[model samples]
Target: MKKKGIFVISLDLELIWGVFDKVDYKEKSSYFKNTREVIPEILDLFSEYNIECTWATVGMLFNSTWEEWKSNFPENFPEYQNEGLSAYAYGESIMSPETEFYCFAKEIIEKINATPSQEIGTHTYSHYYCLEPGQDLQSFEVDLKKSIEMARAMNIELKSLVFPRNQFNSEYLKVCKKLGIENVRSNPTDWFWQDTQKDSLKDKIFRTGDAYLGPINKSYSISSLKAEKDKPLAQKASRLLRPYSNNKILNKLKIDRIKSEMTYAARNEEIYHLWWHPHNFGSNPQENLKDLQVLLEHYKRCHKEFGFQSLNMDGVNKQFQNILRN
Candidate 1:
């Protein structure tokens, strides 16, 4: 008997909530507009290829109106050291009907909830940043409560999570476990890939180079998945299906590197997890979707050749539990 390789894709589904701090929403309005437009296409492609996925959606996206969003705001909201990082302030100060493209996505969330082989996971109530300064377990619990409440309003019971900004801490994980999240998408097992607070120039350079070259390992063993003895299943992400860029040579190398790693995981029956934000597809969506098609095609060939299986984050946890039981 052969152990089966598992493939999982988790999308950080945030509209304006994810990137409001990074760019001017007015200037990049078209980028977000394009993001909203292409989501159905992305889902259609996933369905066509029979891919199962997890959507770690921001809790704010569950709101149908500004009033509902206000009503559900967590009482113990984050007070980031940088006051500007607060999504609450951003929501109050800048939000308007015209800006709804970035602020709201209840329709998209409903579509994902109804889709087969898809799980709705939480990305916190306000795209909460855990590793950032002035954040703690108490505030996080309130955020989690609001997140759960918002999902409950939509008739969704979220169990899987991917921290906003990939921030993770032991106390944070404890909070997640307490709040009913059974599994989470953790960063790669690499030592250099620590939480956001420790990020530096050297780390950024290595991550960029690793995208093109094949030095660092991304595939993980079945035993590695069992490291969390009694905690939320830490399903480590293997690679990011990076968005397309202008440099043709660099882009080709990146995609090739991903395919090579995927092949290794399939051959060895390890896990390969790929992730990215939906807004990444916003700019130059045509090329981004095209690159996605190439990966899906490769996945098809891998399934035929090596018996690789597709799973969402929830499915990954369930699969690992069954593996441990046997």
Candidate 2:
């Protein structure tokens, strides 16, 4: 029997928490509300099909924020500090501890955990940019340790990590290994200075869905000068042209690319790591989720027709480790 391509869906899992820290509550709520409505639908589809996925959650989201909110506002908040909804509801107050955003995140994590086929992993404590020269490696290690510790507090055994901004620092890998992380997702493409280490490794690096499946042969023109506050006429025209040029065509190209990559992986019996942020679906989540559903359905059909088995990070690592030992 021919080996099937390994299908791995890695969700960044830090949607609102990551973005909310930067953007105001109003805009964040709007974005998260859209995301919340879309994700559960996708999760339902994945569950129905028995598709396995890995959610690398931000550690702070799991415990600290709730605790901090509760500690700060005890009387108003009745639930546990960390308790929040899995999906943010529409028109939620940004200041309230009872905001639907936290609740939604919690619910999703619980669902992911309850789903037998799904796997949960850690992204980091702060999802901090350790690649910047200013950030010391020791601090990065401590932050990662804290992330794992947070997961442990929740009784989640952290196994895998996805570097923030796809900015991977080699020293960070050592921290991951020390923390008992089995695998770390590294970029497969060449980067100038940020993830330059990725270029050196041939097969050790794991590629994600966006890298392999995002739009191809799409030309985008942007204003050379940073427009002040107003949207320039030329910029608006370019923006209008971008969708017609790249949206559907790029999506199709990405799907085709993923199909080809899967086929190649199947032939070689190599691991094909397909990852993407759950929030990538934020803009047009339904469409992106549908794209994901189509890919997963293809994977399921291939698994049944061939001998392919879907493996999470742990399974992938064990297989690779077994191969290494032999």
Candidate 3:
């Protein structure tokens, strides 16, 4: 029998919290509104395709109201040198909205919980930036502990983590291990994908072009998905599924590149991990969802013809542990 290729999809499910430091949420209200509406449709498509996925959610999003959110904060907070990076500060600055749709997402989370084959993982309590200056490992630990605690309130055990901003701090792995987190998503080994406080303009340019042109191998062998004992297994992500663009030629090129990479993984029995923020689909939602359906359809074909299997972050980690046992 041939080995099966693995496909993993993770969504960084941070609402406004993910981008408040960089973008003006009030100006992009329509964008966030579209995100709120499109989430269920994304879930529906996942159900239709029997796709398994992980939602690495920001811990504060578990709260339904601003009061609840305030109540759930960790004892210690990340005091980034740049105060703008602090979600706590941002949260306090904004007047509590009548409709807490943007910041709080307990309702959407429940929808995820109700969905089958969907795993809820932590994206840190306040979306803490591990690599950023002025934040220590101790602070990261408390944030992570708070994340696990909040998930438990909803009867969910968070065994997987996706670092906020793809920071992928190796030193923070100890904190994850201490908290019993079994898996984490790591950045690709390529130079352009290096985890850093900020990427150089040259690196950013290459990453953007690479999405449309095929110069990188975005797949990994099963044997490569391993971790040192007592550490959370690091599963490197292959690609970020960029949001739909208006340029038809550019959009086609990007999707084709992803499809080609998926095919290579299937034939080689390797791993292909695709991730994106739910809000990326906010602006061009219908077109984005349509493109997503195309990729899922491609996955279905690969499943039938080449034994490609879809698994969430935790599911992939379990297989890694099983290999260790054997």
Worst 10 residues of 1 by lDDT: 222-231
Clashing pairs in 3: none
Residue 246, candidate 3: how far off, in angstroms?
0.5
lDDT of 2 by residue, 1-326 (tens): 23344555567777665555346555556567776677677678878777777788876566434445333221121122222321121113454555635433656677678877777887776555655444566666776777676567657788877776666666656567767776666554423323442333432232223334333322111112122222111111000001111367666766766665565555444455666666656666666767777777777666665544677766666655454456
| lDDT scores in order | 0.85, 0.56, 0.90
**Candidate 1 CA-lDDT value:** 0.85
Measured with C-alpha atoms, the lDDT of residue 67 in candidate 2 is 47
Candidate scoring better on lDDT of 1 and 3: 3
Best lDDT among the predictions, by candidate number: 3
| Candidate 3 lDDT (Cα, 0 to 1) | 0.90
Cα lDDT of model 1 by residue, 1-326, tens digit:
56888889999999989888878898998988999998888999899999999999999988877777788777778878988779989988876777666788999999988888989999988999888889778898898899898888888888999988888776677678777899988887666577455678887787777789856458887677654544687888888778898899998998888888888899989889999988899889999999999899999999999999999988887877777788
Best by TM-score: 3
Q: Judged by lDDT against the true structure, how good is candidate 2?
A: 0.56
Better of 1 and 2 by TM-score: 1
- What's the alpha carbon RMSD for model 3? 1.1
Alpha-carbon RMSD of each model = 1.4, 12.9, 1.1
**Model 1 residue pairs with clashes:** none
What would the TM-score be for candidate 1 when compared with the true structure?
Answer: 0.96
